[model samples]
Target chain A: MPNRNRLHGEEGRAYWSMVLPAFSIYLLVMAFPIVLSIVLSVSNYSGGKMFGGEPWGFAGLKSYARVFSDPLFWNALKNNFYIVLLSVFGQLPLGFIFAYIIYRRLVKWPGFWQGVLYVPNIISVIVVGLLWQTIFSPNGPIAEVMNDLARAGFQSRLEALFASVGGFNVDDGLVSKILDMAGPAALDWFSDPVPELKELILSYEGAPLSELIGDLCNLFVPRWSPEFLSKPNIAMLPVLFVILWMYTGMYLILFLANMQKIDSQVIEAARIDGASEGQVMRYVILPALSGTIVNSAILAISGSLSSFSLIFAMTGGGPSRVTEILSIYMYNNAFLGRPNLPLANAISLVMVVISFILIGLTKMAEKRYGGKEE
Target chain B: MSDEIKTTALGRIGGAAAKAAAYAMMLLFTAMTLYPIFWLIMNSFKSTREFQVSQLAFPKEPTLSNYVEAWKMGDFGLLFPNSLIYTIGATVGIVFVSLLAGFAFAKIASRATKPIYNGFVIGILITAQSLMIPLFLEVNLLGIYNTRFAVLLVYIGTGLPIGVYLATEYIKAIPSALIESARIDGASFWRIFAKIIVPMSMPVAVTLSILNISNIWNEFALINILVSRTELKSLPLGIYKFSGSLSTDYGKQFAALTIGMVPMLLFYIVFRKQITRGVAAGAVKG
Candidate 1:
């Protein structure tokens, strides 16, 4: 018995020795930082200084208040939710469809298609962002194509107007109101710093705001509709489009892997039961893929919530602070907000809470669905 | 019999239609994914003047000068090595440390196993967004701020939970007989792990390494927040130089982005199997 106890003790010691490094690293990098963030969020930690200065006085709930009132923060959250909605509604179904097509041998080159589809996932996000920017830049190929397609009379007229007044700042309330009256497309009808735009904006000699608005909105706005990342709602469409493009392939690969796990005989049996292909998909395939679909949804939700690099690279959260997601918002506060580290910390804490809530909600949905399916 | 024959004909027609749709989707998705990348490479060869004049047209006279210019702008010759040091060093650390800990949790029947393993599991769910401010503070506190070591340490830390979890799950599948028999032969724990566990757990250790490498290689956020010095910049940050307000070098920007991308793209192409497996394995175990 004593020998056995000694052996057990030795085993315990060995286990501790092995586990110690991992636990220590996790504590330092993950746990400690999280605790520090929570503490800093509540404290009077001003600027980026968390240490080596005057002790920060405790400020209760003020940072939270700042996050609540910030319109940009709300906008960022709404944009993030938009991406989430797209991921769930747009990317997942499309991914699953691709998987079903490939895995079911409806296509001959399954492996080739798989490889081709996944190419986007490997490219650096900065590169991807640059690629799209190249495609849609002010003088990019798309805009040039659109320019060719547009009416020549309208283009020359807009150019002359822009040259006469210089480029207009739509930020002026009166100009914006007037542009709205003319129609959305009239707002940015045609402009990219050529002799025309440079002459227009730079040459402006303070004419009545209405004439500028009328000339700009009624003529130019509609012309630059494909100028992605130009306005908030418009910018979101492209950003969301890219998000869908990049991730659908990943989820497709995932769904394919999961589909491979389901026995072929089960699918064959459904087919033999006089089930149409659609019926087979609805009954057998959907149920089998549900777990993976749920898992993918979880990943998508968490991923969408934390999306930063791609959007940041593409838009820098701008063309008017429209593309700022929660992660980018927090980054701006922490790193770029200049001495606003406390508010950044608060924003990060809010981000974490939201992540947990969303993840929990998905798991609950899965549970409810799983129970019904069973 | 006549009704059955009619239904069969309809079924065949429907199947053919579905197959055609599948072919169309496959072509569309591939084009959607690859076309932009192809365009980036194509335009990298064009001069900015040529790009402006005929952006869609193939370059009449392709130039390597854009690459030379982009290389200088990004200082990528310096940044590539920095990225290598972080990714390789972190990959080694993650695989090694995870092997040790995962081995303990999987092989040892001790009371500490459940809680210690659970600790790593909890570690996986902590998002980097939440950790940004405090992690910045903590790295500074550790006095490793702005150094490559700071990035490396954080990479290993973030990579460990998933690494250990995967290794643990993979190791759990190995029958106790091999490990127990090794123990009964009076082998030391280190020898057993190094020889028996390491070789037997080869596939998973590999998966972990690849995943870690890809992650550390492509990582932008942590390094972006952590490092400020131009020389210490990783490959992803190299593209930022082309984005200045006065950035007029469009040809060079595309070329620089291509330079930044090509190495990773080559790695992915060469090890497509390993990478695909690595990603799927990680996702499955998650």
Candidate 2:
């Protein structure tokens, strides 16, 4: 009795009107922007070019080259990977452990803790950023504890400037060849007393080996500044903490929901076999949850690459760009700086590409884990 | 008999230790989770002097003056209405459009329909980063760059893809006999859609509404770029300025934040069930 006719008439006309509005909006909002970003990236776009101003022109690959060459660009890319590391390496395992504890009834009031932990995810990023600022402020809790430790002669937490960065690779650099030419003086990096000298060749941070400017007089510098939050080497610690806090709850909810879906008899069979709790977890529970783990891993990886608002609110990529990620860097270019639209577009395009690539890698990983993309 | 008794005693002690450890773990995590927000609320009520003296202590004298001062400073009187207008207007637009499209796709079979639905589905994977530049240009081309309506359009536009996807998927599960019966009675497409499909799809409509409202309301990146007019800024955009506004008075800053927070928190608490369901559903779909 269904009118399964396949002819075009008034029926088709009505259908087009119904669907076109939403469809066109998607095309205009999502699809068009992507094309425009690619186009603008390859062209000259700056300083209100579109709003009744100068005409836009093509710039070719100049902007792309600039993006790749800047030290800050490299820093942003590296920082993005650090975020990826925190999400994949940091959030997933912790989220699973918490979810396991609650699901297996190893902890009390599982529902209560689940809801409490998820509270942060719903709050505004601005609030989370400011709240952590209170904890990380120079006179705030974390720094105060660090200061107390320092006063108690626990100086291990304090970083040494030259020795703290990426380690030296004497096997690969021109510096190594130069050291061979300059005799043993250049080879102090290999000597036992100058361990700090050995760490210089690791990367661009004081790579020349003579950039060591320490607090020799200790006049202006305290042995330990309470302003630990401002230090470039450690500013990301609080950001990572807040990130782990804000997101782990959502994943916990995710993993627990997956855990509930698992068949109980399988677990019961293992229990009846006299398998201990840890063994059941190690052998049975973990393998069953691997699919959800892979799915969330993909989610976390893509999410990390494009993260902006939280870091922007907290650091604004400041204290000398220590926490600057690619999105923040692009935002600075577009809205904050001279409104370098071309460069910003180039960066945005690159960010999209990177997110796609990361998502692809994770998808391949998901396939290996035997989970289809839902 | 003595060895068995000793083993039983050791098991009792071990069980007691395990229970205590579980309780401690739960309590520790609960504190870690809630303490920061708790600090925000407590400080919001404290005076400047107290805030300076002890960031952690309970307020010696709780007062509402900070709230009053902050409300005036933030001009929430204007922002609250703007935010409400944006949230309601965009949600309504998205829901209506999605319903129409979803019904068409689900019931009205056509050749082009399949490809169009697939197109919208691809929009899900497009991050805001990629869209940021072109959206700015599109708004400029349309000459709605700083207008509140521009923000509304973008919100509805972005919300459409997911809304349509969910609605289509939901409506697809309905029996085709309902539509055929209405068609046999000579009812028009819209009439049957309104009378039959609309009532049938209420469950998904509700889900879509909750998901759309939360996402549209909390959205920052798109609205931040589109709306430069200070008076037209939505709640999230407006609250972001507090980072710079009250950098000196920590209490007043927190008070402004608390004001910014109270509405969303209340909504979450009231509809916490809907929210959790929506989030879980989203996670499953993603």
Candidate 3:
């Protein structure tokens, strides 16, 4: 028998031929760069020939210091944190509930539900980002709906004011009285009281309050501005919602597949025992899915840490860099105007460290709270 | 007996309520997921002026003008082919390399197998963002920057870790006795692989292709960093530029988006089963 441990001729050649193609590429692209990234993060190489003699020195944590000191980095990190929370807290639970619904056959056409829900995930992240960006833009559907509602509220308020005033044509004195009560915005509409008035009323949807009655009526209208993409404070809100929307489908499918592996007979036996549906979910299904849930959390945390494409396409980290995540920050640093390679490398290393720490915490949490491992 | 009857009645009511809640949740989420895409397609058929007049209203005159204009202005004619080339090239490379390596790791008893396999597996966590800087330098050093070859190399390289890991796990299940018998018959390793392993590994090969196709097709960061030439830009980059240069024309923007989206959606519909199973398997196993 040929010695299996030590391949002599053909066997060794075959192994080398098969392994070298992938291994060399991995080493060249991933493994080598990862190590190089760590080293370059500490070096003072800002740009220019990387290995050639062009202003290369040991920066020694300077890049990291710069990253920490930049308030933009903090904002970016904060945005990523919100996304992580959304993924774990928002998407996972919603996905779980959706999966459970489908798994238990609680809804009709479960396959249709499953297929439709997962559609967003399979589409390109950039496309989904652009689609949501349009939906939240000033001229988009949400804005249209909000504008319509505000206009409707304004029309009703105008009707009430006219009813109280006895008529629309009540001389200049009555118009002044109406202006005093409804604020200055009422002046334009009260003057024409015709085709132009409709446009005038729509334009004054967020008109300032002048008196108690205006304030009371304005509370019902609640001025709707759909300029979210440019607003620094809340730009990430739409991004977060989109993240929740695009990714929940993936986790749903993941959970559904894991749930399918659980024998239906076990669930049947539980049901036959006098356990209610809730009880079955708690005792049998939840316990069975604890491992999958933990795994999904790890995926979520890691994914959250590295979120780029969607946000990059959606906001391009705009509105004074409010929507930037670490990845985008790192990307802009590396590729955008005046590349800062060292700082970009440092940011990436920081991302790696954070991902590991978060993933490690998840695994630890799983060990503690997750019922006996399957 | 009366209490038992009352409890049963309560249980029945609770079950019905739960079912109703389930249906509501499903309907609400599905609508949220689909409505935007539907809205996008509907508006893509309208002129920019019509869209501005009533954003939510159905197009009074659905025209193909937006689509024709977008197709011309976005240069989707060029970008679509570029995307396909990179996606297919990288996916094919990953699968071929992974299958070969997986067979070696599984059937061949080597001291180098464990460490090499472990090395590839570590790449599962090494995201593209982390490696972007060094890879840019490496691609430049290799003298293939701004070339499709560079993009393919990076995609196949970055995608290898998971591909190799999945391939190895799948191939390990195939009986070694088959390979041993083939070897005893004086058949060459390549011959045996061609005859036995290649056919046996089809399921994994399909899964690897699907996973990589979707990933590399939609990949933006690498293509953005590696390729600067306009001719080489993929659909994502094309659409991104369109979003900027044509920001005012919502009709063309929607049409560009529709052009980018429809092919993949069609692919999903056709391969609905394999794609989902492939995606679920890829995620769970990886």
lDDT of each: 0.77, 0.74, 0.81
Query: What is the lDDT for A100 in model 2?
Result: 81
- How does chain A of candidate 1 score by TM-score against the true chain A? 0.75
Q: Tens-digit lDDT track for model 1 on A1-374?
A: 01231235556667778888888887888878878888888888765445667778789999999999999999988988898799889998998999999888888889889888887888877777767766767777778777655545454554455455455542344343333444445424444223443355444557864564345533553445466777666888888888888888888888888888888888777676677878878988888877777777777767876568888888888878888898888888876747687788888888778766765665576676654322
Residue A338 in candidate 2, Cα distance off native in Å = 2.4
- Judged by lDDT against the true structure, how good is candidate 3? 0.81
> Mind giving the per-residue lDDT tens digits that candidate 2 earns over B33-83?
888778889988998778866677788899999989877777778878888
Which 10-residue span in candidate 1 chain B carries the lowest summed lDDT?
B1-10
Alpha-carbon runs more than 4 Å astray in model 2: A1-7, A143-225, A358-374, B1-21
Candidate 3 docks with a DockQ of 0.56
Q: Please, what are the lDDT tens digits per residue for candidate 1 over residues B192-278? A: 888898999999988998888877887887788788898888999888667655245788988988897888889888888888878
Using lDDT, rank the candidates from best to worst: 3, 1, 2
User: Per-residue CA lDDT of candidate 3, range A45-159, in tens?
Assistant: 8666666658688878989899999998998888878887898899989988999999988788988999999999878888888888888888788888987787666666656
RMSD of each: 9.0, 12.2, 5.4
Q: Interface RMSD (Å) of model 3?
A: 3.1
TM-score of each: 0.85, 0.82, 0.90
Per-prediction DockQ comes to 0.47, 0.33, 0.56
lDDT of 1 at A276: 80
